[model samples]
Target: MPRMNDVGGQDGFGPVIEELDEPPFHADWEAHVMAMNRALIGQGVYNLDEFRDAVERTMSHESSYYENWFRAIQTLLKERGVV
Candidate 1:
Protein backbone atom coordinates (compact mmCIF):
# COMPACT_ATOMS: atom_id res chain seq x y z
CA MET A 1 0.00 0.00 0.00
CA PRO A 2 1.04 3.57 -0.60
CA ARG A 3 2.15 5.52 2.42
CA MET A 4 0.65 8.83 3.54
CA ASN A 5 3.54 10.69 1.97
CA ASP A 6 2.86 8.98 -1.34
CA VAL A 7 0.38 11.39 -2.81
CA GLY A 8 1.32 10.82 -6.38
CA GLY A 9 -1.94 10.08 -8.19
CA GLN A 10 -4.48 10.58 -5.44
CA ASP A 11 -6.21 13.93 -5.45
CA GLY A 12 -7.95 16.32 -3.01
CA PHE A 13 -4.63 17.56 -1.68
CA GLY A 14 -4.70 20.60 -4.01
CA PRO A 15 -1.94 21.96 -6.14
CA VAL A 16 1.65 22.43 -5.10
CA ILE A 17 2.55 26.07 -5.02
CA GLU A 18 5.93 26.95 -6.43
CA GLU A 19 7.51 29.80 -4.57
CA LEU A 20 9.65 32.08 -6.72
CA ASP A 21 13.20 32.47 -5.47
CA GLU A 22 12.43 30.32 -2.52
CA PRO A 23 15.15 29.86 0.04
CA PRO A 24 16.58 26.41 0.64
CA PHE A 25 15.17 26.44 4.14
CA HIS A 26 12.41 28.33 5.93
CA ALA A 27 13.98 27.97 9.39
CA ASP A 28 17.35 27.34 11.01
CA TRP A 29 16.07 24.14 12.56
CA GLU A 30 15.13 22.81 9.13
CA ALA A 31 18.66 23.36 7.94
CA HIS A 32 19.98 21.71 11.08
CA VAL A 33 17.77 18.70 10.43
CA MET A 34 19.10 18.41 6.90
CA ALA A 35 22.67 18.68 8.12
CA MET A 36 22.05 16.07 10.79
CA ASN A 37 20.56 13.72 8.22
CA ARG A 38 23.60 14.13 6.03
CA ALA A 39 25.98 13.59 8.94
CA LEU A 40 24.19 10.47 10.10
CA ILE A 41 24.14 9.03 6.60
CA GLY A 42 27.79 9.87 6.06
CA GLN A 43 28.69 8.12 9.30
CA GLY A 44 26.87 4.95 8.13
CA VAL A 45 24.46 5.12 11.02
CA TYR A 46 21.80 4.20 8.47
CA ASN A 47 21.72 3.98 4.71
CA LEU A 48 19.50 6.05 2.42
CA ASP A 49 16.99 3.25 2.05
CA GLU A 50 16.70 2.88 5.81
CA PHE A 51 16.21 6.59 6.25
CA ARG A 52 13.60 6.71 3.50
CA ASP A 53 11.77 3.80 5.06
CA ALA A 54 11.73 5.48 8.43
CA VAL A 55 10.44 8.68 6.86
CA GLU A 56 7.65 6.90 5.06
CA ARG A 57 6.72 4.97 8.17
CA THR A 58 6.53 7.95 10.46
CA MET A 59 5.13 10.51 8.03
CA SER A 60 1.71 12.09 8.39
CA HIS A 61 -0.38 14.06 5.89
CA GLU A 62 -0.26 17.20 8.01
CA SER A 63 3.51 17.40 8.50
CA SER A 64 5.64 19.80 6.53
CA TYR A 65 8.58 18.43 4.55
CA TYR A 66 11.31 19.13 7.08
CA GLU A 67 9.06 18.18 9.94
CA ASN A 68 8.61 14.76 8.40
CA TRP A 69 12.35 14.44 7.97
CA PHE A 70 12.98 15.40 11.57
CA ARG A 71 10.46 12.84 12.79
CA ALA A 72 12.03 10.19 10.60
CA ILE A 73 15.46 10.87 11.97
CA GLN A 74 14.23 10.55 15.48
CA THR A 75 12.40 7.33 14.70
CA LEU A 76 15.41 5.78 13.00
CA LEU A 77 17.81 6.76 15.77
CA LYS A 78 15.53 5.48 18.48
CA GLU A 79 15.01 2.17 16.69
CA ARG A 80 18.76 1.74 16.38
CA GLY A 81 19.26 2.53 20.07
CA VAL A 82 21.23 5.62 19.17
CA VAL A 83 18.93 7.99 21.09
Candidate 2:
Protein backbone atom coordinates (compact mmCIF):
# COMPACT_ATOMS: atom_id res chain seq x y z
CA MET A 1 0.00 0.00 0.00
CA PRO A 2 1.05 3.57 -0.61
CA ARG A 3 1.98 5.76 2.33
CA MET A 4 0.17 8.91 3.28
CA ASN A 5 2.99 11.00 1.92
CA ASP A 6 2.78 9.25 -1.43
CA VAL A 7 0.44 11.55 -3.26
CA GLY A 8 2.22 11.40 -6.58
CA GLY A 9 -0.07 11.32 -9.66
CA GLN A 10 -3.10 11.62 -7.43
CA ASP A 11 -5.86 14.10 -7.83
CA GLY A 12 -7.83 16.75 -5.89
CA PHE A 13 -4.84 18.25 -4.06
CA GLY A 14 -4.50 21.00 -6.68
CA PRO A 15 -1.39 22.10 -8.48
CA VAL A 16 1.84 22.88 -6.74
CA ILE A 17 2.72 26.55 -6.78
CA GLU A 18 6.19 27.60 -7.74
CA GLU A 19 7.34 30.48 -5.62
CA LEU A 20 10.03 32.35 -7.51
CA ASP A 21 12.67 33.80 -5.20
CA GLU A 22 11.45 31.68 -2.30
CA PRO A 23 13.54 32.02 0.79
CA PRO A 24 15.54 29.09 2.09
CA PHE A 25 13.16 29.00 4.99
CA HIS A 26 9.98 30.79 5.95
CA ALA A 27 10.82 30.88 9.67
CA ASP A 28 13.68 30.49 12.14
CA TRP A 29 12.33 27.18 13.43
CA GLU A 30 12.48 25.67 9.96
CA ALA A 31 16.14 26.51 9.69
CA HIS A 32 16.68 25.00 13.09
CA VAL A 33 14.90 21.86 11.98
CA MET A 34 17.09 21.61 8.92
CA ALA A 35 20.22 22.01 10.99
CA MET A 36 19.07 19.42 13.46
CA ASN A 37 18.31 16.95 10.71
CA ARG A 38 21.71 17.47 9.20
CA ALA A 39 23.45 17.10 12.54
CA LEU A 40 21.59 13.92 13.34
CA ILE A 41 22.41 12.45 9.96
CA GLY A 42 26.03 13.47 10.17
CA GLN A 43 26.35 11.99 13.64
CA GLY A 44 25.03 8.64 12.36
CA VAL A 45 21.92 8.84 14.49
CA TYR A 46 19.98 7.72 11.42
CA ASN A 47 20.64 7.07 7.78
CA LEU A 48 18.82 8.87 4.98
CA ASP A 49 16.57 5.89 4.33
CA GLU A 50 15.61 5.65 7.99
CA PHE A 51 14.89 9.34 8.09
CA ARG A 52 12.68 9.08 5.02
CA ASP A 53 10.88 6.09 6.49
CA ALA A 54 10.23 7.97 9.68
CA VAL A 55 8.87 10.87 7.73
CA GLU A 56 6.56 8.60 5.78
CA ARG A 57 5.40 6.87 8.93
CA THR A 58 4.44 10.12 10.56
CA MET A 59 3.15 11.83 7.43
CA SER A 60 0.20 14.17 7.80
CA HIS A 61 -1.63 15.81 4.95
CA GLU A 62 -2.09 19.03 6.91
CA SER A 63 1.60 19.44 7.71
CA SER A 64 3.90 21.73 5.81
CA TYR A 65 7.20 20.49 4.36
CA TYR A 66 9.50 21.29 7.24
CA GLU A 67 6.80 20.41 9.68
CA ASN A 68 6.88 16.86 8.33
CA TRP A 69 10.62 16.75 8.70
CA PHE A 70 10.39 17.98 12.28
CA ARG A 71 7.76 15.44 13.12
CA ALA A 72 9.78 12.66 11.52
CA ILE A 73 12.86 13.59 13.51
CA GLN A 74 10.87 13.50 16.72
CA THR A 75 9.50 10.08 15.86
CA LEU A 76 12.92 8.73 14.93
CA LEU A 77 14.63 10.03 18.06
CA LYS A 78 11.93 8.63 20.27
CA GLU A 79 11.94 5.27 18.54
CA ARG A 80 15.70 5.03 18.82
CA GLY A 81 15.59 5.97 22.50
CA VAL A 82 17.83 8.92 21.80
CA VAL A 83 15.37 11.36 23.38
Candidate 3:
Protein backbone atom coordinates (compact mmCIF):
# COMPACT_ATOMS: atom_id res chain seq x y z
CA MET A 1 0.00 0.00 0.00
CA PRO A 2 1.05 3.62 -0.48
CA ARG A 3 0.29 6.95 1.09
CA MET A 4 -2.46 8.98 -0.56
CA ASN A 5 -2.32 12.65 -1.41
CA ASP A 6 -3.82 14.93 1.24
CA VAL A 7 -6.72 16.27 -0.78
CA GLY A 8 -7.55 12.97 -2.41
CA GLY A 9 -10.35 11.01 -0.85
CA GLN A 10 -14.14 10.77 -0.91
CA ASP A 11 -14.49 13.53 1.65
CA GLY A 12 -11.36 15.26 0.43
CA PHE A 13 -13.78 17.81 -1.02
CA GLY A 14 -11.63 18.24 -4.14
CA PRO A 15 -12.02 21.44 -6.13
CA VAL A 16 -15.65 21.63 -5.08
CA ILE A 17 -14.55 23.13 -1.79
CA GLU A 18 -17.06 25.83 -1.14
CA GLU A 19 -20.06 24.46 0.70
CA LEU A 20 -22.79 25.74 -1.58
CA ASP A 21 -23.32 25.03 -5.23
CA GLU A 22 -26.70 25.91 -6.63
CA PRO A 23 -28.25 23.25 -8.84
CA PRO A 24 -28.97 20.38 -6.50
CA PHE A 25 -30.85 22.41 -3.97
CA HIS A 26 -34.57 22.50 -3.53
CA ALA A 27 -35.82 25.72 -1.92
CA ASP A 28 -35.97 24.18 1.53
CA TRP A 29 -32.57 22.58 1.35
CA GLU A 30 -31.18 25.88 0.18
CA ALA A 31 -32.68 27.47 3.23
CA HIS A 32 -31.40 24.58 5.25
CA VAL A 33 -27.85 25.08 4.05
CA MET A 34 -28.01 28.77 4.72
CA ALA A 35 -29.44 28.14 8.14
CA MET A 36 -26.75 25.63 8.91
CA ASN A 37 -24.14 28.09 7.73
CA ARG A 38 -25.60 30.74 10.00
CA ALA A 39 -25.74 28.41 12.93
CA LEU A 40 -22.11 27.59 12.42
CA ILE A 41 -21.29 31.27 12.33
CA GLY A 42 -23.37 32.00 15.39
CA GLN A 43 -21.67 29.23 17.23
CA GLY A 44 -18.36 30.88 16.47
CA VAL A 45 -17.03 27.86 14.73
CA TYR A 46 -14.57 30.07 12.89
CA ASN A 47 -13.72 33.49 11.67
CA LEU A 48 -13.20 33.99 7.92
CA ASP A 49 -9.70 32.67 7.37
CA GLU A 50 -10.00 30.10 10.12
CA PHE A 51 -13.14 28.58 8.66
CA ARG A 52 -11.35 27.85 5.44
CA ASP A 53 -8.41 26.49 7.37
CA ALA A 54 -10.67 24.21 9.37
CA VAL A 55 -12.46 23.03 6.27
CA GLU A 56 -9.17 22.44 4.56
CA ARG A 57 -8.09 20.36 7.53
CA THR A 58 -11.19 18.22 7.35
CA MET A 59 -10.91 18.01 3.59
CA SER A 60 -7.62 16.22 3.95
CA HIS A 61 -8.75 13.87 6.71
CA GLU A 62 -11.11 10.90 6.62
CA SER A 63 -14.38 12.05 8.05
CA SER A 64 -16.80 10.03 10.13
CA TYR A 65 -18.37 13.31 11.11
CA TYR A 66 -21.10 12.85 8.53
CA GLU A 67 -22.43 9.85 10.41
CA ASN A 68 -22.98 11.87 13.52
CA TRP A 69 -23.50 15.22 11.89
CA PHE A 70 -26.09 13.90 9.47
CA ARG A 71 -28.00 12.10 12.16
CA ALA A 72 -28.13 15.25 14.23
CA ILE A 73 -29.04 17.40 11.23
CA GLN A 74 -31.65 14.92 10.05
CA THR A 75 -33.13 14.60 13.48
CA LEU A 76 -33.49 18.34 13.64
CA LEU A 77 -34.85 18.47 10.10
CA LYS A 78 -37.33 15.73 10.89
CA GLU A 79 -38.47 17.39 14.07
CA ARG A 80 -38.75 20.59 12.12
CA GLY A 81 -40.47 18.71 9.29
CA VAL A 82 -37.80 19.66 6.80
CA VAL A 83 -37.01 15.98 6.35
Candidate 4:
Protein backbone atom coordinates (compact mmCIF):
# COMPACT_ATOMS: atom_id res chain seq x y z
CA MET A 1 0.00 0.00 0.00
CA PRO A 2 2.76 2.39 -0.76
CA ARG A 3 1.98 5.59 -2.61
CA MET A 4 3.66 6.65 -5.88
CA ASN A 5 4.75 9.83 -4.13
CA ASP A 6 6.60 7.98 -1.42
CA VAL A 7 10.35 7.63 -2.19
CA GLY A 8 11.83 9.24 -5.31
CA GLY A 9 10.75 6.84 -8.00
CA GLN A 10 13.33 4.26 -9.18
CA ASP A 11 15.89 6.93 -10.04
CA GLY A 12 15.41 8.81 -6.79
CA PHE A 13 13.22 11.35 -8.58
CA GLY A 14 9.51 10.74 -8.23
CA PRO A 15 7.86 8.49 -5.65
CA VAL A 16 9.93 6.39 -3.28
CA ILE A 17 11.83 3.29 -4.30
CA GLU A 18 11.21 0.12 -2.40
CA GLU A 19 10.59 -3.58 -2.77
CA LEU A 20 12.95 -3.62 -5.75
CA ASP A 21 15.31 -1.47 -7.75
CA GLU A 22 13.54 -0.91 -11.01
CA PRO A 23 13.88 1.59 -13.82
CA PRO A 24 11.61 4.60 -13.93
CA PHE A 25 8.21 3.14 -14.66
CA HIS A 26 7.39 6.26 -16.60
CA ALA A 27 9.80 8.61 -18.34
CA ASP A 28 7.21 11.33 -18.08
CA TRP A 29 8.10 11.52 -14.40
CA GLU A 30 11.15 13.50 -15.42
CA ALA A 31 9.15 15.61 -17.83
CA HIS A 32 6.56 16.19 -15.15
CA VAL A 33 9.24 17.23 -12.69
CA MET A 34 10.77 19.60 -15.18
CA ALA A 35 7.44 21.02 -16.26
CA MET A 36 6.32 21.48 -12.69
CA ASN A 37 9.57 23.23 -11.88
CA ARG A 38 9.19 25.55 -14.85
CA ALA A 39 5.60 26.40 -13.97
CA LEU A 40 6.53 27.04 -10.35
CA ILE A 41 9.46 29.18 -11.36
CA GLY A 42 7.30 31.23 -13.70
CA GLN A 43 4.89 31.75 -10.84
CA GLY A 44 7.68 33.16 -8.72
CA VAL A 45 7.35 30.28 -6.29
CA TYR A 46 10.88 28.99 -6.91
CA ASN A 47 13.68 29.63 -9.33
CA LEU A 48 15.17 27.11 -11.75
CA ASP A 49 18.36 26.59 -9.75
CA GLU A 50 16.42 26.45 -6.52
CA PHE A 51 14.18 23.79 -7.95
CA ARG A 52 17.13 21.82 -9.29
CA ASP A 53 18.85 22.02 -5.94
CA ALA A 54 15.74 20.83 -4.20
CA VAL A 55 15.60 17.82 -6.50
CA GLU A 56 19.30 17.12 -6.07
CA ARG A 57 18.93 17.03 -2.29
CA THR A 58 16.14 14.49 -2.40
CA MET A 59 16.95 11.75 0.10
CA SER A 60 15.16 8.44 0.56
CA HIS A 61 13.28 10.07 3.49
CA GLU A 62 11.80 13.45 2.48
CA SER A 63 10.94 15.10 -0.81
CA SER A 64 12.38 18.52 -1.40
CA TYR A 65 8.96 19.70 -2.51
CA TYR A 66 7.25 17.98 0.37
CA GLU A 67 3.58 17.02 -0.08
CA ASN A 68 3.44 19.55 -2.86
CA TRP A 69 5.55 17.09 -4.76
CA PHE A 70 2.71 14.71 -5.53
CA ARG A 71 0.21 17.48 -6.13
CA ALA A 72 2.31 19.20 -8.75
CA ILE A 73 3.05 15.91 -10.47
CA GLN A 74 -0.58 14.84 -10.43
CA THR A 75 -1.72 18.14 -11.82
CA LEU A 76 0.74 18.11 -14.68
CA LEU A 77 0.07 14.51 -15.60
CA LYS A 78 -3.66 15.03 -15.63
CA GLU A 79 -3.26 17.95 -17.97
CA ARG A 80 -0.85 16.06 -20.23
CA GLY A 81 -2.96 12.91 -20.28
CA VAL A 82 0.03 10.84 -19.21
CA VAL A 83 -1.20 9.76 -15.81
TM-score of 3: 0.31
Candidate 4 residues 29-83, lDDT tens each? 6557656667867986655565444444332344444344545544544555756
As for candidate 1, its clashing pairs are: none
**Model 4 pairs whose backbones collide:** 6-16, 7-15, 7-16, 8-13, 8-14, 8-15, 8-16, 9-14, 9-15
Question: Which predicted model would earn the best lDDT?
Answer: 2
Candidates' TM-scores?
0.92, 0.91, 0.31, 0.33
Single out the weakest 10-residue window by summed lDDT for candidate 1. Answer: 2-11
lDDT of 3: 0.47
Give the Å error, residue 75, model 3: 19
Model 1 whole-model lDDT (C-alpha atoms): 0.93
- Number of colliding residue pairs in model 2: 0
Each model's lDDT = 0.93, 0.94, 0.47, 0.52
Task: Indicate which candidate wins on TM-score.
Answer: 1
Poorest 10 consecutive residues by lDDT, candidate 3: 1-10
Candidate 3 wrong stretches, greater than 4 Å? 1-31, 42-45, 60-83
lDDT tens string, model 3, 1-83? 32232434446355645666646554565556556756855776534454443444334245333333334444444544745
Which of 1 and 3 is the better model by lDDT? 1
Q: Could you tell me which residue pairs clash in candidate 2?
A: none
